[model samples]
Target: MASTLTRLGAGILSKFGRSVASPTRLQSRPYYLYSPEPFHPIPDKQPLCMTADEAVTVVTSGMRIFVHGCAATPIPLLDALARYGKEAKLHNVELIHIHTEGPGILAQPEYDGIFRCNNLFIGANCREAVNAGRADFTPIFLSEIPNLFRRKIWQLDIALIQVSPPDNHGFCTLGPSVDCTRAAIQNAKYIIALVNPNMPRTFGDGVIHMSHCDVVVTGTDPLPVISQHCCSEEEEQIGRLISENLVQDGATLQMGIGSIPDAVLSKLYGHRDLGVHSEMFSDGIIDLVNKGAITNAKKTIQTGKIVSSFAFGSKKLYNFMNNNPSVVFNDVAFVNNTAVICQNPKVTALNSCIEIDLTGQVISDSIGTKMYSGVGGQVDFIRGAALGLDGLGKPILAMQSQTHKGSSKIVPFLKQGGGVVTTRAHVHYLVTEYGIAYMFGKNLRQRAYELIKIAHPKHRECLEKAAFDRLKVMPCP
Candidate 1:
């Protein structure tokens, strides 16, 4: 097996070298394929059921632990661990993750002395802790996080996971959360699971046999539900306009969580042969898939597969994916690579932004100097769409024209100290409720004009003044 992997790696390296030497063939050779599946799961002897307290007891002082990501968070176990933080006097137990759902008591100030958060991706629950200096972040590509574990770079001591009840064959699915859990389970010295019948049994490389869990916490809790926030009339209009621009039979689609994405999906019922290759999805795409709009029929990569790293939605979405071959839950490392993403022809990566400057710098992860979301798979799929073959397509940055407070999102400059999640050069299409601005090769002045045209009428004059002041362009007085 090692010899085979080595040879495969060498072949990939050689191909990469050839691509660097010749750019034309690079486009032709770009396609996605999976490595052969690993053998059926190897089960350990005698899997024991235990309470949440018993499950967390394996974690000791100064140990590094990985928590399950997205909706499949082991909430009962994590809350129990927080309670254990007091009883066991567990000090310096570090919790690392991209994002998790639930109370996240471990991130509270009371547990600061006992637990430290090393966030790979910051979500709202841990945002305060991260900003308060109780936590720190590791800025790495989503595609490389699993490698950190596989290479023993992070050295996981324990993993807290939630899984479905064992099937007839004794294999348990990772449920709705599979992004980093596979790596955590493989790398951790000990694995503890919360087994809930309520958790859906998902398909793909997201399973482990009952015997593999060192200790299992049998708990009954409804899987957490995340419904789509309603899309405003303006958002719906934006979505409709963007959908109108889509090719009649585009083959691949990549969308993230939020109203804009939900809005976009809401308008795609008429389109055909749509495919999904995204980091995560919510309730919006269910109708499309059910209506046979998303057939995944024409995709060159993962053909006929709904490929994603994680999922967040109501129980309905969960039920649909349970044991469903239509969905393949893989690691972020594999799902978010730009090279793999563009293989599906007409890949339209519709991502959101916190705000965008006139010059097209996207500040999606931060507000001014403070961190909000992390540097996710945005750039990965964006570049993938831009470089896709046959002049096929480009990524879309979608957002509303104005903030809830009526402030414009399109500005002459990003807020001071804000991080640029997407560079100016990479932005291809910027869409708002008003219209789309194609700024792929536009100069700074031209970008400013295009962006301002879509800015809310209330803020247009202000932005124009700012741009004029900064660029020394004569204002139309």
Candidate 2:
């Protein structure tokens, strides 16, 4: 202990008024100390158990609360929080987080008078609120989320989380979601955890000792289930084209979750020595992993391991990751770091967006003045894929050329106030159902012409008129 403290850099120790040095594992309270074997829950309950109502009292009015994200969300606890908010006018309590699954009860119109979500990442659960202007959005990188908590910028008043039942050693697991929960749990003033039995005992920086938890609520509710959306014919064709373009035996890959990503993964059945180090993964990657396609043999960073921060899919995906060693679920800060992603050669990032302007301004989060999704790790992987000092690399952004209502997705200009999630400088390749368009180093007029060629045939004439009107050129620049 003395030597460890002496070796401290003094900056962390002085700022936090505590030791910055890491203590010996045996000396420090081991998060998993009571475990005679892994996967075994504690035999007896401790003294900190409380009813749902009692737990809700901790959250006062006008407070800033952080909820656990992804599969680790505590649904019962959030329901209780909503109940309390209804009973006691808990107005102005700001809700902050990335996309959390399940029905966003707090974001509904009934609770609009009390809870105002400042969503950092808009998910389907909170889409209506954002589109209706009842909630707000923040466009930022996922890697920088922890800094907000550590620097006391957000100043979280309470953190609501869910975890696996404690092991024999009195340490609980953070389960499927660890992205920003570790930082939130460490920095919040009061921490309330719902100790659930069904939460997967995931490995990583997700363990918490019994002493660190201020309140524990025993619950038996099942974790939220994620449904897989199927790929359309257009997506399948685009996926085939995208897959055909890839060179056999390429090392690294990064892809966001969706039908197109699944389609692309399905197309890579015959490819050899592929790897995955993505922000998230779906059931598509599972089949590839089973077939030995994703051996992680060619990856430069975290070699020989499938890496991701979180995952959402059917029961098959959850069951596969339950006790799997091949998948290493780390935090978003590490998984989505551009520098780390760039280290892996032939990094291909497959991302989706709502619209792309003629000049290559990608907007994935909104529908023309309506906010849809938050900026969540698209630019991180895109820029990382573009860091091809090797000269043979290309960063690809994939999206359908048209929306479901037959509206054009490739626009002459972004809708006013639409966020430019990806800048023109970072864009390289754009793929749609029609074909692929290379926009790197192209002038404004050439870029417009190439993108229009990929736009849906029904919208092409109108798009051409808009492009020529904007650029003031006869045909196109």
Candidate 3:
């Protein structure tokens, strides 16, 4: 058996123009054979397990460090870095990541000079820092973030990641957040992993051999959980309309976390063979999979598998994903690629917006100039779904007709300085509790009329007058 395995390892290395000295049996379990690249041999030296503070000493001044984001964020490492930076008076230590949860101690005012943040996606923790000019926000699609590292546009010196413990084959999984962290792990000069037993061992592109990690710190804290909230009456109504009208059987779905998406998923219990190819998902998807509602039977891409880049929800969701081969966690670049997403049949991309103008302009990431969130994979999936195979797919934008303050979300014009995450041309289906409006290829005047019809009852009259005045057309009967 040892001789046979040595031959197999040698054959893989030879194909990559590399050689290993006497392939030793590193672990009992077989190496995963899915990734296209050849698996490098495990190092002879065992990984040094240490405390968070000791492992973080590898991070030096002026280094660009990548932090794993979302549910898989390495909190212990981040906290240690914060303490070390302040004590050592470290300067110009740049931290980069997508949206992360928790208090974000590094982004606090006291760490202004010691630790600087370059956020790819602004979450609640970093919003104040970005607005206060203590940190910076990068407006880019989630699909393009991996390329930024792979192409060496933003070279990373170190990567702080949280991962599952090494399986028998000496392989550790990145757990919930494969996303950009896969690229960071591959490209970064050094890797410091927080080995947490609580993290689910998800399969696919997130799996990495422990030989890749330079240092490992034990962390057993519970993974952060974002509970599902009940949708309001209006949101429930809109969700029902979308599930009934737009979502068809065998449709591939891409949706974010929120009450509206949860409401939509709840209503899809009766739908057949639904597939998910989303950037991120929450607990709602687990129910659908268990009920056999999402068989992925008719998907054109990765058929029979639920593909996602990351996940965050209740502990039940993580437990559902633990060592589950049915759910394949991949990098965001592959999951959110326009070309890849378009391959799936009936690709329905459901996204939300902060506000939208009468002419179909979407404001999602920011309210006027203030950055509320990041320009995520909304455009990528929208454009991909719009061009679905044989034109069977649809991109739906669903939001409440009005804010909690009773202000209209559908306006005559977007607030001044608002960022248009989705342009007029990319918007296809717009939904509110009032009804659905198809806006693609419609003239400005026609769009205004269609949008006003779906506005809240109290705001329709004022919206119509503003539309008529701006569009210079007679009010529709």
Top-scoring candidate (TM-score): 3
TM-score of each: 0.89, 0.87, 0.91
What is the C-alpha local distance difference test score of each model? 0.79, 0.76, 0.85
lDDT string, candidate 2, 121-223, tens digits = 9888898888888888888888778778878788887778888776656677777787777777767766677888778777766777554665677788777
Task: Give the runs in model 3 whose Cα sits over 4 Å from its true position.
Answer: 1-39, 475-477
Which parts of model 1 are misplaced by more than 4 Å? 1-44, 474-477
On residues 379-430, what C-alpha lDDT tens digit does candidate 1 reach at each position?
Answer: 9889888888746866899888888899899987789989898999999999
Best by lDDT: 3
* Tens-digit lDDT string for candidate 3 (239-347): 8999999999989999889988999999999999999999999988988998999999988888899899999898999999999998999989999999999999999
Candidate with more favorable, higher TM-score: 2 or 3: 3
Q: All candidates: CA RMSD in angstroms?
A: 11.3, 8.5, 6.8
Q: What C-alpha lDDT, on a 0 to 100 scale, does residue 169 get in candidate 3?
A: 72
